[model samples]
Target: MQHSLISLSILAALASSAVFAQEQKEDEANDKYTDRIRILGSSDKLRTLGGAASLIGELELESFEFDDINRVLSTVPGVNIREEDGYGLRPNIGLRGSTPERSKKITLMEDGVLIGPSPYSAPAAYYFPMISKMTAVEVFKGPAAIKYGPNTVSGAINLVTREIPEDFDMGIDLAYGSDNYTKAHAFHGETAGKWGYLVEGLLTQADGFKTIDNSDADTGFDKTDLMAKLKYDLSSTNTDQFIELKVSKTAETSNETYLGLSDDDFNQNPYRRYAASQVGLMDWDHDTIQLTHFIDFQSVDVTTRVYRHKFSRSWQKVKGFGNNAPSIQTVLLDPDASGNQDYYLRLSGQEDGKIVVGNNDRRYVSQGIQSDFGFKFNTAHIEHIIDAGIRVHQDEILRDHFEQDFNMLAGTMQNPQNKIFTTVDQEKSTTLALYIQDTIKLDNLTLTTGVRREYIKTHYQNRSDNANAKDDWLDKEFSIILPSVSAFYAMNNDWGLFAGVHQGFVPSSPKQNDVDVDAEKSVNYELGLRFAMQNTSGEFVTFFNDYSNLKESCSFSNASASQCPIDTDFNGGNVDVYGLEANLKHNFALTTDLELPIVFTYSYTHSAFKESFNSDFPQWGNITAGDEVPYMPNHQLSVLASIVHGQWQLNLLAKYTGEMQEAAGSGVELSDKVIEAHTTFDLSANYSLSAQHSLYAKIDNLTDEDHLVSRRPDGARPTKPRQGVIGYKFRF
Candidate 1:
């Protein structure tokens, strides 16, 4: 029934939807006329940045047909990812050495708008846009990332959607693969007179690869996405203006569990699912509506957006045999222990017992209005671009969490007990933010200066409180001011230098604030050298983030939570994270009609706690001053190569993620807490049937590499096995 949200949006739109760069019309340029919805409007905007940025252009994305955000972002430098589900239903992305848990440390956006459920109140990315539907991806780091506050410590990513075509245009794609994976994508867009519109829909489903004990349930997931956009153009001689409205809906249902296997059990079969997890399931729906107005007056322009998004979700997963029992991880790690073997026996259905499952029902609302004013002027023959912006945003989260007890008979839940309301958490945040940035250009030197100020107000109610009295609620207020400066110098056509320094901040959750948890703050610095040569381009950069107070959040999703309260913060005092990134790209011409392009990216990160502290946090147990940060791999590398010939293209990509520690420590890594290193390769081929039709095939995990990706929440989790798919696409 949750799928009805998108269906309703379609009816309301009966209303309104660049699959790729080469597919767009050359004469119709959205950038030249109106204000852009994208952060980096074009490749030309990248040049030599005051900071570092990456634009995964349409040419590359369209060629790869990557449905997973993790796969897409792995090609970029300075990005670290931890794979959870074989598919990227939930992505853990970290910029530099920031935390990669649920991507809460980084800012996520679509078309320049915050896309998280409730960015300011609850930043966990339970709802992420489909990657296959995006046209381009823009990533910003360092000082330049401050513009997208409340989360400036890690950085920001913008997912660009397709725009309406100049004329009538439409496309359809269909594919089927291993494990009963299927995909259907279609879109249509057109322009008439001064009005234009676009409508699009996507559906992907699969029969999960894992087999559950004594259960026939489909362990996979099904997802649906729908969108509508309407636009009215009001343009004249010296001015350009337009009003656009966008509506979108996303829904999903997946049978996933946090239960993992013991090391001995994992060694026998990595993909096995315990019988106790047969009841695990999750359902979620999200809806959004946004209106934007843009107008240009010669050298000055103004653009504003008003948006509201709503998200609701419910996840029912196994808790344990008893409420006070040890965490699942504890038992899975040492099943031979006297107290742990019984839990393990019940999990495997070897003995009948009562089971407890928790259902976290959550609702989120995020609404905001933001505007930007741009000015272009010249002073003393020097060109300058000035931008100022202001935003007033409010977001809230309401969680109605409860648990139920069930009698398990042969791995299936029977006689369920009455549901118990375990907790009710309500939190909200309102923020007023203002920022101004100036870009000065003279000769071959460019300098950028920017400052941002934030005024935040928050309210929270203590968990498990049933009273409505004002005394049961807590309110708090705070302010933060951040400043940044960066410079770029072009020594010649082949070489350039860039450097930047900025203040970074990530606010604690509203409830966390009510508990007097301190927000995270840091001073970040970066320096880089860029070069261009014959048929090749490359860059080398180094970055350092010195945090006066670093904060880590603990939840059942990424860490063992028995030692600490749920959804609480742990202060990691005085920490420094330093890293180096390198990237190189080159194009080789095998013949006049055949061309090969290759790209490589590498990153090395080192983190240390400058002050020793004692803590019971599961992920940071017994921290020493020089102990390394957990879940941070010291080395990462990615390589992408494509062979293009007449009417055909073949692509191969391989990535290596170094070993990581589950808990913080230094010296020779302990054997038990280490997540071993692994490398995987993917291959794809595309053949053009005509200008309007194409055929493509791809094989993921070409070598069927089975390796532990993480040991979090539960036990060992493995990557996807080898899977292949063939598909056809049509466009006009």
Candidate 2:
């Protein structure tokens, strides 16, 4: 049904393209142009601080038609992406040495608004923004990320959506690939005298590559997104102002599962799923509305934004094989253990079995108002640029979960029981934040100093018939102040030295007050050099993080082996992390009409515990002073090259990720459950047939090397194999 709907939409778009082209002929002849007014802090110029930051522009985004966030973010340094589903539907991104589980350690935003579900309470990024519809992506790393907010220990990622076009414009893109993959994206916009409006829609679907070992069910997903924006110019003689309103909605249905195969099963066929996961499914819906007002004056600029977001999801998946049964992880790790084989056999429907499935239904809402002021002044010989911001926000997550038992017979599940073991958990938080920063500029030197204060009040409640229910209701309040300073000295037009130091902070979980776990805090330092010439530019930074306290949260997906505790916090004591990140880009103009661009990026990270303590957390087992942080690779590298001539463009990318430990251990030996290093190559090409039409093709994982990517919540999972897609794009 989804495929048919998308096909119809594509056909309509294609038919409309012809009519639009004919109608736009007169407008094209007029050649009218209007300059777009950029919102405050929306341009790439905002990244000109003495720290590491990257801006992925529209050209780069259009090069590969990459819908997956992981693939697009691979070009950045000091970033790590752990693949869960091959399509990156849910990304686990880590910056520096932070944990990647649900990307909880970082600040995620879209159009400068918090995108995470209940960012102040439950920051799990179950509903990530659709990357295919984004116009650009901004990454702020190291001390430079202090401006973004509450979870600044790692970094921040901001997805910039398409702006209201200045002039009339329309575009459509359609693509199909292997495994029944299909995508359709279309947008139309126009700016009149005082108002601009845009409407866009995207649909993507795929029949996944993995197969259920003994079932005929399909592993696939279908998703759709729609957005509309309106902008009104309210400028007058005394004030230059504009008000913008945006509304968006997204829906998804995926046949996904958390149940993976054992080592033997993986060795036999890496793309096979267990029969128990045949009924696994995830359905979700998300909606957002935002209103922003911007005013620009001679010496000052002010912007205010108010936004509200709502998300709901229901995930029905197998929780365990049976009551009192070995966990899926145990069965995958040691299938031959005493009762593990029996449990596995039952789950596979080779024998009479009872499977426990959980209905994880949850709803989240986040709403906030934020205001920013920017001003500049000159005093004596120093010029000062001051920026200040304040935000008042509230977010909450409400979960109503229950379990059902199903009987499996003859490779089929039947006789589902009534819902049992109901649980109602609610987490809510209110946050107030204020920040101010000053940039002092002299002849060849620039210095930036900033401070931020965050006050949070969290409340958690659990209504369940379980033994721990009595201790489930709690309220906590906390406040913290973070400070940062950075300096840049320009030796010449082509060279500069930069250094920074900042405080890193991560908030505590709302439901973990009883654990007395403190908010994660660290002192971060970085030094780097920037060099640029006519056609070459490069940046290198060395960073260190000294943690006073490190925390591990036991969420639904990440828990100890013995117990799947939810909302529990574990203290990992102090930790030290250091890393080096470097990026280089060179453009070679081989001929007047031809040019080649080459880029290289590298990162090396070493993270270790500073104090030893025993813990029941699976990832933090028996913590030793020198135990390496789990899942953090020591080295990562990537190289990309592109050649363009006239209307033809070709690109190639090579990426390598070094070995990483799957568990906290003190050795680098292969026996330490190390995830081996892997490398992948991709190629893309595009040809412009006319001003209104273009053709493109992309091949990912060209080498088709099967490699283990992760061994976490379940068993080992492999990355996507070779795949190719061809598409057509039209613009009017």
Candidate 3:
């Protein structure tokens, strides 16, 4: 039959040309990924201008560590966190006035590394990261934090983590809040063939809001964590290799003592436990190891850390009623250990220039072995975009055992001249450095400049006693050269205009278990303005920081009639500070449709101490020059707001602190309330039915208000309370 009609018309024209070549290859792969990953996550003013505390995810992860991350960063307006006798153990973070204890001036990072405090210790410990796998947080204050380097004179916090995307996924979160709190978390990722994996775990427990009555002990908190990551892909130029491991532990039990409200037992029994049944005990542990290598696009890194701590205290159980009541119990401890070994080699790529080299080795038998070398430079010209770096460090500070225990809150039967010895004291040091930076763009104006130069060398050997304590090794060295500048202007397209000036240094911390000292300087100035439309935004600043010679650790005069053994005193002073900071943000798309956020911040801090320290100490006291610097705080305001429709979300936060001075030479008896800033609130909800499933809920300190976040009161300390929480989350 005519060859069956020509083979059925050639099989219907080859099935219509293979269905038009599969619809033209699916419209050219959907126009190259629908606009480059949706312009990298909905570019809202470039994600709030590269986030530096314009309030980012989870409100910039404030809690620093726990307290439910300050119940979600206290709703943002003017953050403030406190915990005197609560669960978060010893927690406090007051923005604006910049309080966060040894936080010095805020500068924390994770992912991008740098865990803070330990440039060679002397009162510097509090990096404490591991926020159960944080995903985002970035805040930059002061002179925009000068790109993260040494406290930045008051701001820089970045904590971003989350990289498991390669397919298969899993997630889990569980919680029970309000006092007995309780938390759990888990995550998993996969990619079998080329090998890729991720694992995470966390557990938390709390049983406190403060409600002890004389002593039953246990105002508790406990934590545990584990993390693992691995990846290896070598598909010809697909190169990649990464391995990560982490371990953590946390514990805090307290009865509270900063000594503020005790006038007849303050409120009769405000979480009271008349000191002594073992008040305040802490145990902390952390471990980390990392190795990464990515090719083509460059990346090489290695990191290591092992930290251990054991602290115990009990100082209040010696009362007499009618027969010399003696029930003795006063204790202290130092079962501690520390370690750090880091090495990095970087050469990032993305069509831009980047290079890095680093080394940091630190051991703690009393702080020794601190070797460093770092360099970096990133470039782009046409429209400018450059970042630079340089660093060199060296150390030999072997003189451990509570630093030859010179009475840091004496004990052991009440200071029998204070005993607790452990020494290595073979001090040797060298720290050479160089730095340079630039960020420029003309059309709409943008400029940033930097410079740094430093050199220091010192040596001291074996000294159980160096006459009055601060030996000046032969011709020890000290040199400094610092400079910085910043500017930005971009009216049109949402406005912008900013200004800056900067300088900072720190070179003293080795009161000669042998030698090393002469490095403490600061100079900073700023002016600013930056605003945007969509999603609302704002940033305004005015600041000044002046510190010279600084260095403090006094107590040498008349060394106990020349018994001279060594009583500590390494003085040098000068300090002047000034500031004004304003930040605002809003994201409202007519309520309930999703996304309604707002944030605000205000600050003013002033300090002085041109010099003068020995009139029974007190006009700010201690390492003198006017003393108000210890944790700076002289008026601050804050606020945060939120509202998210669909699945519910509501948040609000607040903070206010003014007046602070509690160290240097404490004459005691001062209390404009060293730290009295607080306010917090939170709420959350989530529900999704597909794409892996989801359900969530959260509430923290909704209103339980009544606060006093922190106060060392210089010496008699006591102040911390007010807490609440609730949570639940799951995804698969």
Candidate 4:
């Protein structure tokens, strides 16, 4: 029975080489389409996983109907998120004690494949998938993380999409909300003969919640996503085999900016955008195609996946005033400090001045092929299951940046200068990953050991008009071997304990000079307990990461142009991070027809540098032996409660995120100009009008709580204000 529990999601894909590939239904084992990368979405699999993992299923995902990944992740322990844009667009996410900047320190995937724009060259998720169309989300951590690859320092996240149905089915969801927001989502799936197919589409648009100075321009965004999947079973081959093809496209246009309000301006109106930022905007398009082949033999299983992704993005936003060299932080922190008065006045549209804007245009290509093999054997009284995989991935990033000078006349642009090339560059990486994991089970104990080998060759070419970058376009290569071990012991049918240790690594960006920076390396450890009693079940885990050499990658999304130059690596020396994660859930029977379901999650994280150092990297500047890491919260908590009676359900959620620092400093960093602690609540009510129709109403930030969310990459930013929405759903 234990061997039959197939691992899908991260468990199979474990790190870079898939181990369990999928979870197969005993009855549907012959139809590879029936297998799912569940990511241990069920409690039973998680209890014996020998690691820490969480699954957000359809029931919970549709409860709040959250279109934002940040809000949804709050309910998972050990996750840290930094909110921006009020919406979850371009989310800053972290697991355990990893940096939450741009979510580059972890592995991100969709349906068991890497999904970041350029996971190997430019990992920043400037274009994340639409969460509204996802059927489930899986979070993986601990030693198991080593099985997932590239950035095992933190963890991994996999977004699972809807699968082709076995029977005819279709559904549609429509909603209207505040700020002129609108959403439409529809999906259809059916099986015919030996073929199964699914088609889905989603559209979301909004007028934005921010007001522009002397302008009525919308600050919101519009996004569209379409996907189609086709699968065919090859029963005619006289063996259990199937092939599936998936194709998807996404396009978006958002009027967003990196510029935030000054401290004084934010205090007065946190939602106001300065006239200088009127040019802020971004447009992007992404397309992906994937093909998968599955074969089930008498003694082994095989899964082969081939995927390719192409993405293009163009963003135009205010760079600065005049020379565009002065740091925005300097002027915003003290607008009346004589030297900053002119910049401040001009920013607020109170004075006519020349402003500079820049356009960041980039294209990305990511393609890879991976194969997995799994088999079972027995030796004496012990049983063993072995999973081995190989993957070859190549990704590239092409960058072209331009800047122009503009004259601001009375809060409106007057004359504009011709665009000039600022930077032109390209980065590429070719990676070969091989991994194998063995799961040994004897009685009530399950033990797993795995090793992953990585070989990466990278190249960077800079063709900037400026001399800041080298033109050599040199290539560099690096290789490493990582090992992991974990075990789970069942104390009884209701209690289990797990522990693991693994070697973690994160590769340097292809643009790195190699001589100055070594790839990030660390040893990670975790221990936990799983318990279930009646309708109550919970997990408690503690993790620690000891870094021998930490590295920081700078990006415009989290750091200033002057703080840390883009496409560069900064050495962080030695460091240590430790944390605890706890999650509990229970259901109470109120009556024969009513029930109450509750879930609670909490996270505590702490980090410290081993040696004192000074650097331009904003988050790690002037680090001391005992100084805490910036942007890392000490406490995070989330609670979800819901009542179900007949065909009616009501849900409430509360989240609390502790204050964070813009830069590493004392524990009271918030005392300065850092983000302050904040709490928010959300409510949702849903009623099923027969089995074919349903209605729902929801409100975000129900308490109208106002708080500062960040202070870097510009000036000051705030959380979203209160908003509400109503929707209807139809399914047959």
Candidate 5:
């Protein structure tokens, strides 16, 4: 049933795109020529469409509004987006199937700054900057991302914000949706008297669809964000200088759990039922400030930030079975728990063309402790770009006070609280790297090549009161170097083809100690073609990613007892991934002056544990060759079509994912389960009531079809149900 649905959906989506493309061709017969498109990585935006080898490409923000970031990813070939929690905020992302850990494998950047809480933590959580603030997203898969530093072992996603316009412009939008969702956003900007300024703010709140603990529906939360930018024309020679500030706060409350469900359980209590679970609240806030200076061939940039986060939860659970077991198996209850604290820190830096150098020093008393320094150098010579950088980080942890309780007869129970505890621990690690790249321009092709050398070292010391814990687990560390190379050819003015092979590697995670796990590595090969016509444009890419020494979460000896550590070991395994993506856009010169755009994607992945393993218990401890990796499906596809006529536009998108197994399976249950593929349709339109005002209504999952977006091995938890939204926008 699952396979059939997936096949049908893929076929339907392809059919839709084909029809849409034909319609667009009919409309493009007499269309006007579009202006040259420009893609920006830095505010200086000094570079434009020149060579296909550049990290940046021409892109537009208007297309991003059609859907959330994940849905829009189909527009870009070779990129993939996955949603573990289904779009409340923190989304899991992956590209080229570079090890299916999703966000863990990809480095996410907002204006050149990493947004994840801990780059080394498992199940890396990421907030890719609200979609409303971005103008374009520069995606660098495989080796192209090596320049961004660590964690780009898989790829990198850079969220680029809107451009600073010279003319005055202001806009406001308000929206209301099903499930008690509301949002408001506004922005204003202008340039006058040799000075320019811009400010924007957004607020969003929602009362989710599924009810948990009998009330206060789970997934409800509020998120607010604001930003400001100021710029000055130091001299008439276009020597620009700018300052920008960004701030955001998110408060979420819900009765939730970390447990996921199996196929049968998902079909049963899909809403997720936990009698002992009660409403809980969590709060988060972040702030950033950046300063930039630019001239003809030289530019400088600086940035810093202060961040804080707090979380709490309430729940009840039975502790144990005693000799005085109640006649009716009486239940036990306890007070809800809280994991709350504020993370405070400030990071500063400076970078310019004259001499590329920067520093990142941080201070955070909570969420552990950390201090770090970063430096870089860049020198350009005839046909060569030489870049080198290094970072040093040290950390200290603070233990806090806590209470413990349990249940007794008749009802829940609680014991006395434990004593407060504190510990002094120091750890230091450093990453040193150097790279030399040369871009040679021939008749009509550009050949680019670069090789980077990286070295890493770490040492740790601990002074603690816990006698059972070791004073030092890791003694010292060593290093390894990775190399990459690629080339791009402009096969003429309208078409270009680029192909390259690159390597990636990640140092052992701090969470894992005692285990002799080597860094993970991968080699990627890609061939892409891009084309642009007078009235139409499109891009296609085919890629294959191969990985080795893949990391696997497993149990190891700890305190003479076999246990699963936060970080595990590198297992002997290999994975091969391939995919294709294409996007087409065209404008019609019909009487109605309509425009049509179509996009499609197809992906496949295969992986295996190269050998058998046994370290823990018997039955569930062995991993054999040909065992598939979890989460990543063998097949995936998506297609989207949109039409614009006057002030009104309509869009339809559909996606299909093949059946996939869950990670890790004991002997009793199947290693993986099939998720029946599902498809949904969204309808949206905008009507201009006047030159300055407009109204928009969007109905997502229009059919309200019931389906599972993800299947937890435990009991499945249904995501936000179907929804409808109505909104209005005003411009001045």
Candidate 6:
């Protein structure tokens, strides 16, 4: 079946290319009179690439006041974002059908630079850029993402920050919503002669809606962000050069938890929290500094950047109820079961439960220097655009973890242990990467080919408190080469076709107990078509991924002993994933001179483990041949409609997420292990009071429907209730 699909895709591409060639030849005489359009860093160029890509600009971001990336990304086809925390503090992003845990399978960036705390050593996204402060977002999927990095098995997501403006400008935004949610964002920028500067700050806080039935602690978060940028332009009679310096800081405190309620408890009160999780909290701080230089020449453009980033976080949460007790998830699934009743009673504070609290404290630092050169020239009637880049990076993670035991007395945590136990686990890595790609353009056809080389050296150590315990450092080295090719043909001004195939790569989890593992590798293919007319535009794409090895890591903090040994790894030998994505947008003009815009997006994904032989990982429990990959919905759909008048705009958005299995299984037969399908609607309105003033209002989940969002790491969790916000913006 897969082979037949591949053949049909190839045939379609060839047919389109032949038609394009004939059209080009027919219009040969008028080629000289046609004007060429070029946008250096624009969405049009990205969309026409031989793969699936989408650029969400400021206007689209403001349409619904979507500060949460999951909500904003729903409009894009083939992009899947899982909601963990009600707020998008840490997004679990998946491209195509890759795993979405911690967003580790994909490449994440800010301002075109890798933003992971430790991209090379510990790629878990403990810290994410603030989406409310970003000016734009760029999503690159399929084979084109090979240019980004060592974790491109999925794709790449780039957050574009606000840049220094060419002229003086100032703006302020304020909003208040349900749950006492408040936000304030302000920014100012100016350019004077050869110098330009910008400063921005954001503050947001909320009093959460969920109730801690046994405690008075606020289940909310407070966050602050500050950024500054300086730019200098050096323009002379012979050359042009520019330099930019940027610094940013972020701090956040949230009372969050991974411990959820039992099925009965959830049914009674979906927003209730267990007393054992009263101490669950996360506090973090991040700082970054970057310097970039740009040089422009007659035929080439060069850019160099040097950056350093540091992050520190301390998350204190309930790790376990007792040594011999059932896991939180097991008790939640069947609280009345024989052995689970006792555990459920302990979690409810009716019994003496030795609650284990772990202080997961960690610090990370990443620094790198990278440069990119782009050259454009023409030779033998063919235009060539070549891009090459190289990077050297070093990153590490330092951990100082400790734990304490306590008991809940009369619905209150008491009898805390005075003695605390500690352990250390650290990892460091040094990496070098180089990549080059050339795009060849001839009349109506364009071909792009690229290759990347990566070399990495990693070291890990585990320190024990016992004097007799053995402590030694282990080292490992890896080298990988990846290549890709793609083609795009413009059949005419209104029709086009593209296709590409590339190799995907992802580094294995850090060594565990002196066990070295091989890296995960896959071959990915994509074929798509683009169509645009006077008032309509759309794209349809089909993608397939063949994985040689799929890997999963287990953490003691989240997984139970029955799931997998702590700090162990599980490999799912081979897998196959295929999907289809389609998106369309159209504009209609009314008789009253008003315009209405409609947008539609849909995706279908089918992923399965081809040769499943499971070892002890609960996520891949008793895997069998043709078992579907967990947590990936087979169908997703969204629609948007907007009305535009003189100075007012209104939009209505609706989204549907199909049912999916919560664990690796043949089908969704078990209710506890299935995430049911759900639909949500949103409404937004914006009005311009004047040239410098505007007002906006948004209401999310307008129907106030209750639904389960996830059942992972622990027990089932519900999505946030309806929320409404009113805001005002001022500009000068």
- lDDT digits (tens) for residues 337-396 of candidate 3: 121000000000111111111111123211111111212243553354443334343434
In terms of lDDT, model 5 sits at: 0.48
Global Cα RMSD, each model: 8.6, 9.4, 26.3, 7.0, 15.8, 10.9
Q: lDDT rank, highest first?
A: 4, 1, 2, 6, 5, 3
Sort the predicted structures by TM-score, highest score first: 4, 1, 2, 6, 5, 3
Question: Candidate 6: misplaced stretches above 4 Å?
Answer: 1-40, 418-423, 468-472, 512-516, 556-562, 565-567, 666-672
Please report how far candidate 2 places residue 595 from its true position, in Å. Answer: 2.4
Among all windows of ten consecutive residues in candidate 3, which has the lowest summed lDDT? 340-349
State the local distance difference test value for candidate 3: 0.44
Tens-place lDDT digits, model 4, residues 607-648: 888998877676666677987777889999999999999999
Question: Where is model 4 poorest over a 10-residue stretch in terms of lDDT?
Answer: 18-27
lDDT of 2 by residue, 1-732 (tens): 999999999999999997696446423311211101122233334334588877787889999888889999888999977787788888888898889888888999887778898887888788898899998888887765677788988788888888888799999999999888999999999989889999999999989889985787789899999999999988665556778999999999999887777768777888888777888899999999999887766467777889999999999888876557777777777777887887788767787778888888999999999987778899996899987889999999998988899887777777889788666889999999998989999888889999999999999988677888868698989999999999988899878899999999989889887356888899999999988788988889999988999888876555423354676778888999999999999999999999999999999999989988877666777777988888889999999999999999999999999998877843211225768899999899999999999999999998987788887667777888788999999999
Q: What is the C-alpha lDDT of each candidate?
A: 0.84, 0.83, 0.44, 0.85, 0.48, 0.80
How do all models score by TM-score?
0.94, 0.92, 0.29, 0.94, 0.73, 0.92
Candidate 4 runs further than 4 Å off: 1-38, 236-238, 322-325, 464-470, 665-671
Estimate, for each residue in 1-732, the C-alpha lDDT of model 1 and write its tens digit: 667998988766654312233223222335633334676677666666787788898778877787889999978888888788888898888899888888889989989889999888878888899998888999888887777787888689999888877699999999999999999999999999889999999999888878888888888999999999999988665567788999999999999888878888888998898888888898999999999888777577778899999999999888766667877888888889999988888887777888788888999999999998888899899999888889899999998988888877877777778788876878899999998889999899999999999899998886675565345676889899999999999999888999999998988776675354678899999999888788888888899999988888777777653556666777887899999998899999889999999999999999999987776567776777988887789999999999999999999999999988878843211224788889999999999999999999999899999888887768777888888988999999
Report lDDT (Cα) of residue 466, candidate 1.
57
Clashing pairs in 1: 17-198, 17-199
TM-score of predicted structure 3: 0.29
lDDT of 5 by residue, 1-732 (tens): 999999999999999998796445422311100000112243221111221221233233343243356654644544444444444365556666654343667766655444544443322442345765566666666555555546545677776555455688998988898877788889899979667788888777777665543344455667677777776655333222233344444333332333333344456656554322221233444454444433221232122222222222122111112223211001101111121000000000011101111111112111211111122233452343333333332322222212132222122122423322222343444445454555555556655666666565554444455674575556556565566666666677777677777777666655446366656777777777766667666656666667676655431101001123223555544655566655555655555587776655556555555566643321124566666555566667666667778777777666666765544333422333445556666566667788999888877666776576543312344544567888888988
In candidate 3 the C-alpha lDDT for residue 481 amounts to 67
True-structure lDDT of candidate 6: 0.80
